[model samples]
Target: MKRSLQITLLVVVAALGLAAGLAWQAWRDQPATVPDATGTPGSDARSTITSLVVGKRRPDYQLPDLEGQARSAAAYDGKVVMVNFWATWCPPCVREMPALEELYETYRDRGLVVVGIALDNGEAVVDFVDPMGIEYPILIGEDDGIDISRDYGNRLGVLPYTVIIGRDGIIRHAHPGEIDLEQARAYVEPLL
Candidate 1:
């Protein structure tokens, strides 16, 4: 009886240790949270964003711009639109602002419309724009930001989410985090 009990204890300990090891390995393999458009880190900072696949109509919805003017997805019809969801607090988002602005300027004449959706409600966005020389339209999203993001397939509500809508109104690609300029340029130039 004593020998049997000792063997069972050993097995239980070994099983627990194995379980812990597996958990650790899984955690280590997880991706880091991406910062929002600005330099501020958010609670969902460590999540990974995936690209939107082809063959889907771009999610359409109406949102208010910074001045509270109603804007709809249809406003950019017949043109290639880049919709970027960002916050002034996200570091990565801020880091890529200049690049995005430059990309917009380079393609605006070719029917490229870059719209920035600010996820934060505070005055941070208002302050960040001027210094960054952001020429595109910036809109406030408030609490409805998450809902708007979900409509664009960003279920995790990650900042710096970008979706490219082709001229035909099809969603060409949706990036959940920061925009890759090279990839963005490649996708937009062809659509132009």
Candidate 2:
């Protein structure tokens, strides 16, 4: 009976894992949409953004930093820009923060600008990053960040999405997952 129970538990874990994977994939492939501030269906945000590609010019947007100062793609002109969309509550996002900070520090002198867009409350973002010592500029987007991310070519609005833009204003790469220091270097050094 003990052996049978063990087998049953193992099967349940496997099934749960499979179900989670499937759910994640489905969400990732869902057609992009953004709701209004009133929580009603707004429209397909992808209409304005379209599907971005590696060679395409980075989309234009202006979001405020923690201090409510507006930041935009034009501000980073002639710089290697990495725009990362994340939230303070996401584990993967938090996990990669150190690596991103390190990447920003290592390449800032060489014209690398790592801009982190936090899709959450400004106070929460400030609280989280202050303890972590994240030096890169962080923009507060709340709900609109998702729409801006779609402009950057995130179809499903996934967290921890990163778009690396070259100094010429062309997007060089789009990384859509938690990144380590090694992966950051691999994607950034070539552009720098």
Candidate 3:
């Protein structure tokens, strides 16, 4: 009887340990809170990070250009504007910069304006732009930058969020990752 009781107690302990382990594993699988496209607290779950509609109306905020002049969304009105939020450390952001510059060069004459909002320090951006020869304007942003991003529908602070606004000042598309040139062209062509 004593041996049987000991075995039963061991089994109960083992069951509890197994249950705890499973619970921990389940918790580990859950997504952690990170910056949303807008730089606000958000989750990384793909289901929650899909395309978010930002709608019309430009967000009002002041950010300095490389030359220290104040720039705002109003600066690019009546043009097809592509506002891209990126950081220096993001590999995808680096990869997309050349394409973005090419796109800007190709379409700038045709009324396309591209703006990059650097969600990092101004000095880092300075370092990034000089070597890459980025022709489009890049604005240095802070926490409030997320607010502008949110206004354009980027709730998850994911690097490389692009908002394309039409000539009417209405937001036409919001992409959360690296944008393909063809796909971007398709979205902007209608507005042009």
Candidate 4:
């Protein structure tokens, strides 16, 4: 009788585990629900960082690209621009790079431009970007990135910070962390 009871308990546990695994698999296969530019249910859509910079004309800066080319924010005045501040050492920054590249390519011909401000050395930025096949204009910020980030409204000086400027040169969004592709699209699509 003891052996029979033990077998029954094992069978019950196995069944429960199988049921949980199946449920998890089903949930994993479900599509992710993308939130719109407005607030999603149970969450405020407005970001404090964006609130600080939005509606203000983006500050101009001239930073050097990888090949010693001077790229100025002022030069992109008539185009919608995304300026992303990132470091090669930051994991979240690395993870979201591909998404940024894709977003840039998708909207480049539609009046949207994406620029990456790498807070790392030019050599390191080149090494990191080359492996990832990053094709956007990358500015080497080095140590001056802290001050530049502050000018862009990133008071805390977070990595992977992003600022979106509309075609009229007004800041639209300032985000301080990694952003998914869908969320980025939502922010840029309406302007295009």
Query: What TM-score goes with each of the models?
Result: 0.71, 0.73, 0.74, 0.75
lDDT of 2 at 184: 84
Query: Considering only N, C-alpha and C atoms within 3 Å, which residue pairs clash in candidate 2?
Result: none
User: What are the clash counts of all predictions, listed in order?
Assistant: 14, 0, 8, 0
Tens digit per residue, CA lDDT, model 3, 1-36 = 999999999999999999999999999999997543
Worst 10 residues of 3 by lDDT: 38-47
Candidate 2 has its poorest 10 consecutive residues by lDDT at 34-43
- lDDT per residue for candidate 1 within 67-173, as digits (tens), equals 67888889999999998888878886887788788999999999999988888883766776767778987777777766777777776667777878889998786
Candidate 3 segments exceeding 4 Å error: 1-54
Q: Which is the better candidate, 2 or 3, if ranked by TM-score?
A: 3
Off by over 4 Å in 4: 1-46
Query: What tens-digit string does per-residue lDDT give for candidate 2 at 1-192?
Result: 999999999999999999999999999999966321111123243232234557799988888897889988799999999999999888989988999999999999999999999999888888888888889999998888988888888876767778889999998877776777887898899988
Model 3 scores what on Cα lDDT? 0.78
Across residues 1-192, which tens digit of lDDT does each residue of candidate 4 receive?
999999999999999999999999999999976333222322222365666788998888888898979888998989989998999999989988999999988989998989999999999998888878888889998888767877888766667788889999999877777777997898899898
TM-score result, candidate 3: 0.74
